[model samples]
Every structure is written in structure tokens, then in C-alpha cells.
Target: MNGNVEVVVVGGGYGGVTAANRLARRDGVSVTLVNPRPEFVSRIRLHQLVTGSDDAVEGFGEVLGGDVRLVVDTATRIDAAGRRVSLAGGGTLSYDYLVYAVGSGAADPGVPGVPGAAEFAHWVSDFEGAGRLRSALDTASASASVTVVGSGPTGLETAAELAEAGREVTLVCGRVLGPSLHARVRRPVARRLAELGVTVLEGAGARVTEVTRDAVQLDDGRSLPSAVTVWTAGFRVPDLAARSGLRTDADGRLLTDTTPTSVDDERIVAAGDAAVMPDHPFRMSCQAAVQLGPAAADTIRRRIAGKTPAPVRMFFAGQSLSLGRNEGVTQFSYPNDKVNALSISGRTGAGVKEIACRFTLNKLVSGARKASSRGSHGDSGNRLETPQPEHPTTPHGTRRSA
Candidate 1:
């Protein structure tokens, strides 16, 4: 602990980026963020990417710290024993503290035909998948039926986006539409989707039994004609942590206690959708990722200063589900994330959703730039602005704002 603390953050998503910037605020802590992509992806807008409403990318400067090292590379393996991370491209980097935040991806439901049908289905999980989905929509015939499997927020938003654009869309809900919402609030969501011209298929026959290129077969022997099938069911995390010999949960997320430190190794910590906080077990969402990121950084910072870290507590306002540009739904929830049943819909809901998305970006950028004000102007709080000219570079390029 005498020398500089070498902290390597894996994954450049919201959690990792937030941690890197916050950690860079303190001196004697070397922060390096390794990610597969050079640009920061706005995951909240990835669905917009599919609908051609957003590009969902920015130069690292907009979201990463001025003093943090940015390594554009994929982590192949983690050697926890030696504190070394092997890169897919080659070579390895050592760290005194490792922050695991690789995030999650589209899950395979182990259906009979899911794996083979994946090639024909569209996904909104990542940047590459979103781009592919956009291209698919372009080539799909104007009157072709677009079936969106699942009724989660992403599925709902995508179906609404396509329907609003005049595309024939169907939302195949395995159970019920907006299952997370209370029965009272879910009624309005159904009415809104119906108003938007989305076919909400629920009940016993709605569960997907098979996926084909041109249609999705349900358990009730009904086959919905789908020119472009989109699967947005469940998600699974990367297996890097499990393969690295770290103690992880069933889904490969690192198992951590209140401190967010790996049960097997005190030097390793985790955050984001990929993390399963044993104490709180928060759901995988950007809301949790933002907080978890800084918490992980604060833990490392505190541990280096010979102090114990505090457990993470997250706050929730509501769930924002965009029906389209003009219609949406916002379900109020307590700080514990329990639905309070208070709701908003139509344009007002859409406005709230838009503000949340924009505010999320502002918070990320502001958090990253907070390190620049360290000690110089007596500024210590997390406040963000566009990057300044004096911001230092790491290796080559990977910085930008706006």
C-alpha cells in the first residue's frame, strides 16, 4: 500500500467508466479502464439505435476521466492469483485492485430451436446487435409482420417504436405485458400499446415454443408471421469471472458481500448488471450500475487509506417505458423499488423518459470530469461539464464530449 495503487477496471460500460473517473480524483491511484470498444455506448439508447433514432456512441472523452488510462481491448482471461489480466489481442496487465463490470447479454433460453433461429432474429443488447437490427429493418418489407418476443421494457419500447413508424408489430409476451408493474398500472400500459397498434399476445398460448426465420411458433400451436423477429427475453452475464477462478454466482456474476469485494479475493470487486450483490441483490439496470461503479471505486479508495468501506444502497424513482415519441408510461416506485402504483402516461410520460435519458448522460460526463477539479479550485463534489483542452491523453485517442 506504500506505492501507487494499481486499479484496473474491466468493462467500459456505465459502471466501469464511472468508477475510473471517480477513482482518478484521488492521487496515488493509477486507474486504467480496459474495454472492447473505443467509444462509450449509451446503452439506454441502444433500442433507439435499432429504430434509427440514435447512434448510441461517443468518444471516450465524454464519459471517461481525463487522467484515467483507456485501453481499447477485450479481456480474455483474468489471472487472479498474479493480479494479471490477459488481453484477447495479446499481453497482460497487472493490477492491485480489479473491478469486474463486464455487463450482460442476450440469454439463450435453451429452447429446441433458439440457437439455430438466433441468426435470423434481431437483438438490441449491444452496439453491434443494434446496428444489425437497424439494417434488418431497412431490408424488411414495409408490410411484413415484426414480432418482438418478450414484454420487458426493451421489448415494449422497440415494439412501440416500430409501430409508431407504421410498421406492423406484435408483442409476444410470455406471460403478461409489463409484469413488473402492479396489476392496476399494467392496465393502462395494455391500453396504450393497443392504442399504438401493437398486438399484445399473452395467456397460455403466448409463450414462445420455437423461433423460425419467418414466424414465431407459440405453445398453443399458433405461428405468428414474423418477417423480422426480435428476441428480448432474458439476459446472462459474461463467463470471465467464473472462468478466472473467482467465486461467482450461478450466472457467472462475481459473488460479493457488502463491501462488493470478491469472497475469495479481497483485491477484486464487482458492480453493474453483471454483479449480484449478495446483501441487496439489486436488479440489473443502469440505475444500479451508476451507483455500484462509484461504490466500487470508493471501496478501493477507502481500503487504500486503511478504512472500511460501506455497503451500497440504491435509490429508485420509477420505471420509464417509452411507447413512442408521443406516448409512454412512468410507474412510480418507493426507494426500495416497490411499485407505489402512481403513474403517468402519454406525452407527459414520454417527456419524463427523455429527460431521464439525457440526465443519465449528463451525470456520467460530469462524474468523469470531476477528477479534473481535484485540489486546483477546491472543488471536490461530483459535477460534470464538457471536457477542457488541458485534459491529458492515454496512449493515443479515445476522448470526446457531447
Candidate 2:
């Protein structure tokens, strides 16, 4: 608090946390993290949360590295040229560098007269929405009809979970299920859906034009009666970046270079769903966010040290989809969007998805611990010459060891 911090990371999602931890571990840097939420919500598990399988929230104190100071406040504006950020709590923070990892929100399709859609359609994209969806599911009758809009992973997962829980589920897809999947993978996925008792409507081009308490109207002049509706069509970035005069895509995502730095200002960096890397913008997924986090941190570290940052290497690790508690699909993709010959599904696939989720959380925790340990040692070394007072350290000391 005495001097200007070296780096300020805005947002507390996967990308923001990773960048903050990595930056704080560097030899000569101070890191401050800003976000409205005090906890990190595991968005990937949101589907499961809606199905009452897992709690989606985790405490920030348990996740953030010791070296990183947490500021629980919304970022209102960015003064990139001045290296300062305005917080909603009437406080301003200045930094030598800034990272923007503010994520995206569910996109609203511009269908006319979609009454009650915003108020009734439940989305699993965020924790609050998921909680509401879960509560509604609990109150829904045993034979209640559940309609899911969108064919992506979230929609499929929600549909399958409801079906597995004994609720009648109908999945409405504008295109074929798993539109991005290869035909070979799509067939098995469809089969799995059938086995789970989920009615799959394909190529319906059914756009939800209106939502009533018990029914939804589609563009094709069809009405589907349902007790609940879940929407997972697409996502849109927050308007913070655009309103701050940063260069953004038509969808309001901050435009960044390959290294994840804002094209308009190198001092401003972005990651997660809020950033669109112009040279090689990949789909907005947790997979990309995890990689982008450390990549952004490295770029900032290099710049602060006056060294040229290395170019980012974008790679598609793979895609994993969960059908429910005991079924899933894992499609491996090559670096050039080529589908791998091998695909996993069913019980084995569920195991794989579970492992992947655990791996992601474990990676975050491990990275944070490493950063915290490094910071503590560095601090101890600095204070070695000034202190002579001795006190017994408690088991839960201020300093944490890996």
C-alpha cells in the first residue's frame, strides 16, 4: 500500500486468478486483484450445480495466492493511459500494468416478443442463475416437462441431468446436436441422449419467439409446452471494455493481440471470454481461459523487465461433454481443428470428464500454492535483517507453505 503496485488483475475467474498468482510469484512485482465476487465460481460445474450434484462456489481466500491482495469491488473504468483503474467503491488503484479477465454473459437472441423469456428462462452460465434453475427444478412436479434451448454442452448437459432425475426433457436445437462435432461423434452423442430419455429436436431452426408460463413459441409456428425452460444459445462480453473506449469486436469483446494485450494499449491486457485475440481468436471456453491466464502473466512480466514477450501458441487441447452423472463424450481435436479418430463416450467418458474437472481445480490450487510459497520466502528474506522479535507461529499462520 505504500507504493504503486506492479500489476493489477481485474476479474476473479480462471484467467484472472492464474495471471495474478503467476505475476505475484515473480521476483520483483506486487499484485492486486479486483472483482466484485469474493469467491471463484467454477462455471464449468454450473450444469451439475443446477442438477444438485455439486456446489459451484469456492472461497477466494482458499484459492488466491498469499502474495495477491484481493479487492472485492467492481471495476467501473480503466484509465489505461494513466495506468489507473476506478473501482465502484469510490477508490482508485494505480498499477504499472493491468490485466482484464472480466468474463462474458449469456447472449440474448433478438427474437421478437419473447415475453417472460428473460424472467423465466433459466441459464446455467452463472452461479446465481444455476441456483435459481435448481430451485425451480426441485419444485417442478415429477412428470414436469423441461425444454432446453441450444445444442451446446450446457444445453445437452442440463437436458440429460433432468432426464436422469426423472423429469421429462425436450432439447430444441436450431441446428443439429453438437453442430461443431464431427458426424462420427455426433451419432454416439445422439444415441446417448436417446438412452437418457431426452427428446432431441434437430434442424428445427426453432427460435424462441415467446415464453409463457407453460409454453414457448418457436419461429416455425410450433408451440412447445414445458414446465421449465433453459437457454444456453450463446454468450456476450460485458460492456466495461467498450464503454472505457477500448477497441472491441462487434460483440463488445475487447480486441487483443496474440499475446493477449489490448490492441489499443499494451498496458491493458485481457483474457477469458471478454478478450478476442484478433490473430487467432478461439471459441470462448474454460480451456482457453486457463491457458490465456498464464500467457497474459508472462507477457506482463516480460514487458515489466524490458524483455520482448514470446508469441502465444494457441492449441486446441480437446473437448469434453458431460451427458449427466454417468455418461459423457470426449472429442479430441488436433491443433488445426481436425478431429481425432479416437472418441470416448458413456460411463468411461463421464469418468474422464470428472477427472478433467478435478484436474482444472487442482491446477488452480497448485499454481496458487506455488505462488504463495515463493512470495512468503521472498518476504521472509527481505525482513530477515530488520526483525529480532520472536513469536511462536500458529498452525494456520499468515504465511502458507505449499
Largest lDDT belongs to which candidate?
1
Question: Per-prediction TM-score, please?
Answer: 0.92, 0.90
* Cα lDDT, model 2, residue 31: 81
Predicted structure 2: clash tally:
0
Steric clash pairs (candidate 1) = 61-399, 61-400, 62-400, 366-384
Looking at model 1, residue 199 earns an lDDT score of: 92
In model 2, the runs with Cα more than 4 Å from the true position are 1-5, 109-115, 377-402
> Residue by residue across 1-402, what tens digits does model 2's lDDT show?
234347878898999988888887877787878777667899889988887788877766556777776766788898877877777766677778899999876766443346778767888888787898889988988788999988887787788877887789999887678776878888878998899889888775566777777887887888899889888888877788988899898888999888888999988877788999777868888988888899999998888777888777777857888888989999888985567756899899889999999898888888778787874544421100111114211111233212
Q: What is the lDDT of residue 296 in candidate 2?
A: 94
Worst 10 residues of 2 by lDDT: 380-389
lDDT of each: 0.81, 0.79
What's model 1's overall lDDT? Answer: 0.81
